[model samples]
Target: MNVLLVSRGSTHHGGHDAIHRLAAAATETTGVPVRACFLDGAEPSLHAALDAVPEHCEVLLVATHLPPDRYLDTWIRRAVAHWRSTRGRRARILVAAPLATQPALVTAVGDAITGEHTTLDGNPGPFRSPAWSQITRHRRHVLVCRGPRCTAYGADHVAATLGNRLKEHGLGDDVLVTATGCLFPCNLGPLVVVYPDDTWYEHVDAGLAVRITDEHLRDSMPVDGRRPRDSPPL
Candidate 1:
């Protein structure tokens, strides 16, 4: 049997790292092949993890979050069903209870608070790291529209590809990429807007998105043919 531990992934790196640690520990303790997967906001999504499972294998999916959520559980069920139908090879899937449902976890938390092994420092220190402040202090911010209509046209793929291109050109630190809802030109999606230059590009596919990152984002050269004239800019 194979095990996949699922977490609601974070935008920040640490949260995902923690999930990896838990998966490693679970494997070490049980000698089971274990992997960590995310529900959203990170790569190796639940579907991706399921795809990696060997065909005809019995698989167990365990949620790593505290306080079980009906929405997440329902989504997992639907995702598992979809995966079974879409993949050429199929695996037997079983949804296990979340880790936090264990009574030992509740006792451990109470013990941590009551046993006085924790500290509550009241210092009003820095909210974030200086390095974080530097990384976010970019000259240009790029917004990719991810509205329902845009998503139908592959906006998510566009955003991921654009982000990769920006990083490849060493512009990721200098450029901030944000995913937004309903940029208001659904027919022209997937749309990408760059600022403070206020340049808007419509119908951006992965290939065109890479070009925009290299030519327009890195070299300050806009592809005139792709821009919409009457579009509002940030």
Candidate 2:
């Protein structure tokens, strides 16, 4: 049996690396092929990962949320069932019990403690943060999509280029850049959306990111967003 660890993916490669280490550890102990796949924001999405598994071998899926996601437990089961129904594949896919319900959860927490720990104090909620209450005075808001498709296409470079170029062009103070999860129309990613006027750009790379910093954010002209493609069918 092959082990597939499912995780809530991240835009940063470091996040994926941590999961990879976990998968490697599992493979070492279980004496089986163990791999990692993301739910979103990283490559080899759940569907793509599922398709890669050979039909001859069964897959044992394990979820990797430490505190456990509020909805992931229910969502993954339904999503997997939907995939199995739609794909009609033969190999068995069994989901391990949700991480939240595992008896080892409490034991794992207890084992981690070496130094003294403080009791829970839930006062001063997230909304109480001073930064959260304040709005940015920046002139433009730029959103860079870090969804799985975009990341696969090099959204990380695009994002970094935007930031560096904006600072170089002296637009950093005037422009706000945010790396966001899944700005849709994911087919035309690495995607960038600039607001106050909602100018959308698709298939952006480092080159286009620099262009956006110079032409759109700096000059206030929405850069050319289309590629050399003919009109779509009506």
Best by TM-score: 1
**Cα TM-score of candidate 1:** 0.68
Could you give candidate 1's per-residue lDDT for residues 117-164 as a string of tens digits? 746788778888767755467978999886545654566578789988
TM-score against truth, every candidate: 0.68, 0.55
Q: Any runs in candidate 1 off by more than 4 Å, and if so which?
A: 113-116, 122-124, 127-140, 144-161, 179-209, 219-234
Q: How much lDDT does each candidate structure score?
A: 0.77, 0.77
**What's model 1's overall lDDT?**
0.77
Specify the poorest-scoring 10-residue window by lDDT in model 1: 223-232
lDDT tens per residue, model 2, 1-234 = 888888876537898988889889988998999998876555555666777898868988888786777455665675577567767887788888777788887787787775477888887556566788788799999989976557656676788788888888888679988878886677798899888767789899888888898988999877886432332754
